[model samples]
Target chain A: MLAIEDLHVWYGSSHVIQGLSLTVPAGGAVALLGRNGAGKTTTLRAIMGLVARRGGRVRLDGRGLESLPPHRIARAGIAYVPESRGIFPSLSVLENLTVAARGTGWSLERVFETFPSLTERRDHGGGALSGGEQQMLAIARALMTNARLLILDEPTEGLAPLVVGEIETLLAGLKETGLGILLVEQNLAFATALADTVHVLGKGRIRWRGDGTELAGVPEITRDWLGV
Target chain B: MLLDPTFLAIQFLNGLQLASLLFLLAVGLSVVFGLMGFINLAHGTLYMIGAYIGLSVARSTGSFWLALVAAPVAVALLGMVFHVVLLRHMQAASPMKQVLVTFGLIFVGLDSVRYIWGNYSHGIDLPAVLAGGVSVLGETYPIYRLFIIGLGLAVLAALHWGLERTRLGALVRAGVDDRETAAALGIDVGLAFFAVFCLGCALAGLAGVVAAPVLSVYPGMDMSVLILTLIVVVIGGPGSLKGAALGALVIGMAQTFGQVLVPALASVMIYAVMAAVLLARPGGLVRARHG
Candidate 1:
């Protein structure tokens, strides 16, 4: 379980995330939907401690994670997959996976099994992999950390339709395995399908929050807040 | 004269010897700059300290072998202290600030060595076992120079194996590739970088001890080798191991052969090579992938 309350972040004079609060229950999915520069990415960054949070209380399973470093936060069971996929270009596919492996639950064999495309290119450099494969490798790497919570930023962005379907299927399976996922996505269909609850963000504030099914009838939220 | 087999063979060996020293000096500088983006102008100071420490150890123990081992360990420990106390703080500072601080450290290191040992050249006695000459191409050559070449190759091989086949090497590669991602994956990058920094310092010490017998230990010795080492890193591409190896060899052979072949232009030939390399590939022979 993850809980973030009244998170405030600033980039010099510009306020990025202003008093945002959210929660993801164990084995549940929460999707943050917003347009460009709506602070969705900033919220994820604040949770990961990549950016300094001026004010916030982040708790993972009742323990405070506000002051921890990024590495410490990761080890505490949060695995972050950035928008770029964060693959080490010089490292081989296998090295990229093993570099962050926590030696529990997800073994190299399991990852290879889960991602057969990756298995074939185990010796290939991470940079050499295609966009679809890179995204798969990123998720697979996150799993290798044995993390209970997976934080993904725009995993479906710039992906092919067929590859998007594959990723959606893979994530659906992961959701069934009781892994809590907090996803920031622009694809409304993908987000609504995978997430149990959806929150539309507008100008660093949550404009609407409700069940994924309820979001379909509320066209105004999607039109005004998410710019759909 | 250039066609003479014996003369060419001797020059070839001389070039190798110079390359060996350059490799030992440049590898650490390359990796540190590449991984942490820390411009350590004071790295050569470690080499000078290693030589001074080696001289002291050899004099105290009357054993060149003992000095070789003791000097690197001492310098590495000293480097660890410096990193924790000073260098680590500079990691977040501007590059200009990092340069100024490290450059200041070069003077501090130089003045410290002067205050302790005074401004005079000293030499380490060649171990009796390696004191004699060996026959090569119908001419005798110093075995110690060959030993230097062998040592360099051995270190290179070891480094190659360590970096390619080990988990620590994987973490380092990952850190070098993307520090933020590596950290977010739960790697203690700061600790790993600390280990690397100490190793770099140790290698510099090894180079200083190894070169002392041939180059002799002297005041401002760090400055001369620092220039050559920096040139090697620049030409090799900072952060690339392969680049450092290739760059060191290139510079080493160029400096060695330049001295004999173009006596008038020898002093500026290495600089010319560097400029030509920059013109061809501004990123150097091998580029660090991320930046």
Candidate 2:
């Protein structure tokens, strides 16, 4: 369970996230969708304490996370998969997963079992993985931390269609496992498929909020806000 | 004399011994640079301090063995204090600032040693256990020098195991690869950096203590060793363990053999090797992850 109240973030003189707020209930999925430069990524970054928040509060359950650092936020059970995936090119696939591993809920063998494609590449360097494998590795690494919240920024970006399908299926399965997910995505269909609630972001503020299924009936909002 | 097998053998062993010392100094410099992008020009001063500390312990306890253990531990503790008090703040500072700050500490370190230890050069007596020469390749070599070589290899092996097989090593490699991401993964990256800086300091101290019997221990002794350690890191590639090893070997061999083979141009040989390596591979022998 996570909640954000009136979040404001700035990058120097330029204001990036302007008084934004959203929530992802326990075991629920919330998707933040918008066009490029719409502050979708910044919102996630601010939540993870990766960027300085000019104003507002972020709460996990009931505890405030505004004063915490990135590592502290992560330790508090928020696993962030950045836009870059952030895999260490020098480390092996197994090392990348184990480096951040925390609890008994997720083990090395468990991760390998879940992603059979990665089992064979355990000893290979992270840089050597294919785009799909890297994306899987990123998700697997998050799981290793036994995090209660999974915050993913554009996990499907630059991925092939088949890989995207695999990722979507994998995420859907993870949702069934009761992991709270806050996702930022440009892919409308993919977001709608997994998200229980959808929020369209425009200019760093929430412009629309509705059921995930209701978004398909509204074209004007998509055209004006999402450019989709 | 130059073509004699015994002379060449002795020279080879001498080069190895020098390389071992250089490796001890260079590896720490390489890792610290790689982890934080911070240039510690005062590393050689740490080495000199180690020798001074070792001298004090040896003289007071009359045990070279005790000095060997005490010196590195003291230097490591001192390094931790230095990092917390000053270097930690300069982590995000510019390269010029890092260079100037650390370079300033060199003089401070030298003068401080002089103030306490006097300007006269000192040496430690070799322990009886490692005092005599051992026959090798139809010649004899000081057991202490051989011990340095063995200790270097042992440290190298230990380092390799720690870095490759341990969890802390994985965290370090991950931090070196991407600092922000490592933090996001719940790793205390700052702590890792602190540990690495301390480790580097301890190794330099160890090298100084180990070399006390073989080299003069004096206030300004850090200068020549500092320059050579820098070259080793550069030619070996910054932040790479393998690079440090190769660089140390090349420079150490060049310096040792060059003295006998080309006494007139001995001072220029190591520099020439660095230039040649840079010309071929601008990133050094092994391109480190951060480099």
Candidate 3:
């Protein structure tokens, strides 16, 4: 249950997220699909309160989140997994999980159960992990927050096909648990498979918003806006 | 041969003693720099404060132990006050501004010490119980110097344990790696920074209190230790405890050996080692992982 209305974000003078609006109902998986430089990531960052300059409203369950600091916004039941997968490289996987684990119901054992690869390499430093392992660790870390809403930016970016399949399965499983997810992705097929709703963004504006079924016949929209 | 058995032993002990003092100063410097990313050029002033407070407490109480325990506590409290009043305001400022502000505080601290303690160098006489020396490898060493070495090792052990084994240490380590991420995890970053700044200042004060007997208390003592501590931090690598210890030991031995074997280079030996280390690693002896 998150609603962002006419959100505007800027980096210095460049307008990033311009008049973008989106809504994710409770227990829904919403995919924000866009090409490179289409402001999908910026929208997620605005929601997390990490953007330098922001305007308009970001409401979570009817409470304004735009004015809150990143930490405060996070504490109010949102977890952000940034595009870069901001893992503390010097920390062990277990240490990363431990640092992010805040409340009950998201213990190390539960996280390990969700991502068993993390349990196997629990003692290894984060930097030493492979891309797939690191992504798992990052997702597991966000899950440890027990966040009501999880914002994932490019969750399957730069991963192998097999690993991408694993991530898809993971997302499908997570969506089944009634945890709301806002996924920023460039992959249409993967997004269609996991997302209940789809929003196509182009030039900092949302061009389309429909059920996943509508994404099938939009060839021109994909070529012009997504270049895929 | 210039290296006789007696001479070598004495040099080794001297190296150990110097290492102990350097460790005390450098670890504090490391924590302050590592956690808050604050370049507190005035940290050495807190060390000077410790010596001054030690002198005043010892003079009044006539007990070396009283000064030892009380001086650092006083300095720690003062450090907390300084963080609240000064550092908190400067947290978001540029590093250059922080440096200038801290440098100004150094001048103020030196002037305050001079105003209170006067210009004369004050020394503490070793307690009579620790005044005597015992035969060590058939060589007599001052009991106080040995005590300094032992105390330094004990402090190092305690610090290592507290930082590496405790939950608080984990929090500090997480904070140092990424302050924003640490905050996101519900850690009170501001409070942690304040506590760490005070702790670092307290260590500097402890160094001052411990070194008061060996080095006389005076105004310029701040500059003297400040320069050397910087060298240690640079050579050891920023924000590394083990690196600081290694840097201190290396510099201490270089200084001690220089004084004995090549007296002219004794003053510049630390700089030479730092230059060599920088030339090799360019990032200091230990490199912190950056995101």
Candidate 4:
């Protein structure tokens, strides 16, 4: 379980993630949906300790996480899949998977089974992989870390419909294993499919929070904040 | 000079000797830059310290082996201390600031070496086993020079294997590719950097110790080699061991071959080759697969 309260982040003179709060319960997938520059990514980064948090109370399973470094926070159990799918380009796909693996919640065998394309391209360079394949590699790498909480930033961005479907299935399957997931997505359909609870972010604050069915019925939040 | 077989052969051997030494230093420089993105202009200073320490140890112990063992270790410890005390603080600073700090250390290192060694050009005598020349291709050559070549090849093989196959190598490559991502993956990036910087410095020092018998151990020696090795690392791709070795060989061959074949242009021929390589590839001969 992960809980974030009154998170504040700033970059030089510009203020991003101003007094935001959210939570992802055990085995719960929380989808953060918003238009561009809505502070969704910043909120995830703040939780990961990648950015300077001016004010925040990020708690993971009752442990305070605001003061720790990114690596320490990760070791405490949170895997991040950034938008760029940060694979070590110089390394082979196998090395990429093995290098990030910590406690081994999912073995390389399971990862290979899940993403057969990764196994086919095991010896190939990480950078040489296609966008969809890279995204698969990124997700596989996150799962490899054995972190209970996964912070995914636009995991389905630029992916084809088929690939998106695969990702949807993958997340749906992963959620069954008691893994907490925080996803920032623009694709409403994909997000709605997996997320039990959804929050619409406007500017730097949570504009709306409800179950998938409730959100689907609220046309005002979808139209005004998400521009959907 | 025009078409002499024996002359070319001798130059070829000399080039190999030079390359052997160049590989040791260039690999360190390339790796340090590749791993941490830290341009340590003072790397050559560590090499000078090695020579100075090796000479002193050899003088007191009367054993080349002891000097060889002690000198590089001392330099490594010194490098670790420097990293902990200073370079660590400058990690996120601008390139100019980092350069200024490292460049300043070059002078400080030079002064320290000078104060200890008394500003004279010193040289090491080859161990008794390698004191004489052996016949190679019917030409007499120093056995110590051959030893240098052999030592360099052995290092190249070990480094190549250790980096490409081992767990440590995976961690290092991971750290180099993306520090934040690597850290997020539970890698101690700071520790990796520290280990790499120390190893790089020690290797540079080892080159100084091993090559001291041939090279004049003087104040400005570090500057000349630093410039050449920097060029070599650039030519080979900044972070690759293969690149460093290839660069060293190319530069060594260019310098030695040019001296014999085109005596007039020998001094500038290496630069010409570097220019040609850069113009063609721009990324160096061995491009790192990552950005």
Measured against the true two-chain complex, the DockQ scores of the candidates, in the order shown, are: 0.87, 0.86, 0.40, 0.67
Q: Candidate 3 residues B92-118, lDDT tens each? A: 899999999999999999889889889
Interface RMSD of each: 0.8, 0.7, 2.3, 1.4
Q: After superposition, how far is residue B211 of candidate 4 from its true place, in Å?
A: 1.1
- For the record, the alpha-carbon RMSD of candidate 3 to the native fold, in angstroms, is 2.3
Which stretches of candidate 1 lie above 4 Å from their native place?
A: none
Angstrom error at residue A99, model 3: 1.5
Weakest 10 consecutive residues, lDDT, candidate 4 chain B?
A: B1-10
Find the 10 residues in a row with the least total lDDT in model 2 chain A. A46-55
Q: Flag regions of model 3 displaced more than 4 Å.
A: B125-129, B178-180, B184-190
RMSD of each: 1.6, 1.8, 2.3, 2.3
- Candidate 1: Cα lDDT at B248: 89
Worst 10 residues of 3 chain A by lDDT: A98-107
Residues A1-228 of candidate 3 have per-residue lDDT tens digits of 899998999999999888988888888999999988888888887887777899999999999988887777887888888788877776788878887678776788888888888888998887889999988988898889888888899999999999999999998888888889999998788898888899999989999888678767777877788887
User: Judged by DockQ cut-offs, is candidate 1 incorrect, acceptable, medium or high?
Assistant: high
The order by descending lDDT is: 1, 2, 4, 3
lDDT by residue (tens digit), candidate 2, A9-104: 999988888888898999999999999999998898888888864679899998898998889999999998989999999899989999999987
Task: Output per-candidate TM-scores for chain A, rounded to 2 decimals.
Answer: 0.98, 0.98, 0.97, 0.97
TM-score of each: 0.96, 0.96, 0.93, 0.93
Q: List the residue pairs that clash in candidate 4.
A: none
On TM-score, the leading prediction is 1
